[model samples]
Target: MMLLALALLQAAATPSDAATEARYERCIDLATTNPVAARSEAGKWQLANGGWFAHQCLGMAYATEGGWSAAAVEFEAAARAAEVAKDKRAAQYWAQAGNAWLAGGANDKASAALNSALSAGTLTGLQLGEAHLDRARVLYATGDLDGARRDLDAALAVVPEDPLAWLLSATLARRAGDLPRARKDIAEAESRTKEAPEVQLEKGNIAAASGDEAGARAAWGIAAVGKGAAAESATRALAQFYAK
Candidate 1:
């Protein structure tokens, strides 16, 4: 997942920072339409003592190009700079760094950055919820199922409307043999939306676990026709069923 960029430049509070804010906005504006140029601009700005915002702009530019590793590096630098400046947005920067690190396939680094963000005690509401959710992904990937479950629960508590959190909670509940909890969460997910392939796949998993073979097959079949990682997973699930 990509980090949500702050709209800091959208409303500058003082004239002294107007020029810097305009430059930051320009860098962000180019990230979508001309990321290469944005990167070049950010590099120049950084060399000109543009400080943390320059690194942040560079990170956004790299993220636009799917250069995850470079984005992570820049985001981490920005986070550190934000912290040193005693900026309230430091937690958000750390969270963004964590997300970029995860995108770069650095789970350990992601986990550490996420920890820093959470420990900052500054993130609130959905932002904090999302941080917990990403940390859960890292924990799950590291085989720390218990830790993942705790984080997922925390995420759901803060963002009950998040279908992904419910789906993951259901999947983990099922794996832990808490069928009742799993069914409840999966039903909640189903009520929210049925368009996601992963949701369909989880629906199938719950059905299969409950010995409802036909229901499982139906859901998985729908999911298998979709694209991306979820569809690939659904395909593997269907193959396993047929092989049995």
Candidate 2:
């Protein structure tokens, strides 16, 4: 989601004219409001030599339509084009490609793209932190827990205010059997957002692991109030707890 948000914010590469800038802006707006139209507009622009900006918009359009693999291809193409032009935005495009790949469940491709982005060392601040976080997610999915932990630590160091980073770090800690770390990280996540079901679920897990059945039950109850995967998982956890 963050990556998608970033894509929406992308500006054209110092457009040669105001008209080009306006066109790019319009295409990006269409990407969010009407992805099908955006795709057609971007395709036309690309045929007219819109370069990396056109590819980037096309990627955003695909992403908005939930076409993750197509989005990744377009983003990677944009990154390559930017690189050929010696543009600093190439790193950002690579990061976007990695996010799309991750969304498509292609962890290997995600890892490679993210590695390219980070290795460039052009990203900074929140962008840098998010790139690390995305790579961590890929690593976690691929069962490279230690590598994921390292990347999560890097992300937390750069973006301590991000609740998702804290939540994921807490989840990883709990999975690694580091209850104390889990509790600490989850508390940080809770401070940022007390009502998130995922945070509450992690809290329940950490509490359960610490042998506090009542605390776990209460947290899971809070988690179960919502609908979706987290709530379903909380319900299952509650069922198991009751059985015990």
Candidate 3:
């Protein structure tokens, strides 16, 4: 499961001066209608202003077309520009760069950007939680389970209501053989978001761990109807269950 926080970041990464906001709004509109032309316009704006917002617009244009690597480059440029200007928004730009890097599956680069974001000491509340969660993902990918778990704990403390945080926490707890914590965490995630296939899949796994075959079957059946990887996983689980 992934954090939904990126959409919020994308909405307000730039400074909120009226003129800049107007330009950013136009950039958004044009990005939806014509991404190529939006990139062109943003490129010209960058040449003229060379401000963080210009790079933000360029990132937005690239992101519209699923160009994650290009988007990460533009967001890193925005971050560097923000740093040069001593803007507090540098943290957010770096976080956005991390998100783009994560989307591109460049976990090492994502970790670097996220580290810069956290080191900025400007993020608070859900933004801080998101950064921690992203770092946890990188740590988990790199087999640093203890570090990943610590970050997930930090993320949950900051954003307890986030279903994705709970889901990942549950997964990590289960992997570490903390079945009770896994069960509790997945229950919390289920309460926050009932339709999440990852939650359901985890619930099934937790039930299986507890030797509750019926519970496992029920949860997996529900999860199998979902779209994407979770559904495929649930289907495989059910097939394996019936095979035995």
lDDT of each: 0.81, 0.87, 0.85
lDDT, candidate 3, equals 0.85
RMSD of each: 3.5, 2.2, 1.9
Question: Could you tell me the TM-score of candidate 3?
Answer: 0.92
- The TM-score of predicted model 2 comes to 0.93
List the candidates' TM-scores in order: 0.88, 0.93, 0.92
Q: What local lDDT does model 2 show for residue 16?
A: 62
Residue lDDT tens for model 2, 170-200: 9899999999999999999999988888889
Give the best candidate by lDDT: 2
- How far residue 159's Cα lies from its native spot in candidate 1, in Å, is 2.2
Off by over 4 Å in 1: 1-16, 240-244
lDDT of 3 by residue, 1-244 (tens): 4335563235545456888788888876786678899899898888889488878778877887879899889889988988998998889888888888887899999999999999999998878888899888889888999999999999999989888888888989989999999999999999998877888999999999989999999999999999878888999999987788
For residues 1-244, write the lDDT of model 1, one tens digit per residue. 1112222212112114788888888888897679899999999999999878888888888888878778878878887987898886778778878877877789999999999989999988877888888888889889899999999989888988877788888988899988888889988887887767888888889889989989889889988998877788889989987798
Model 1, residue 244: distance off in Å is 7.1
Task: Point out where model 2 deviates above 4 Å.
Answer: 1-17
Worst 10 residues of 1 by lDDT: 6-15
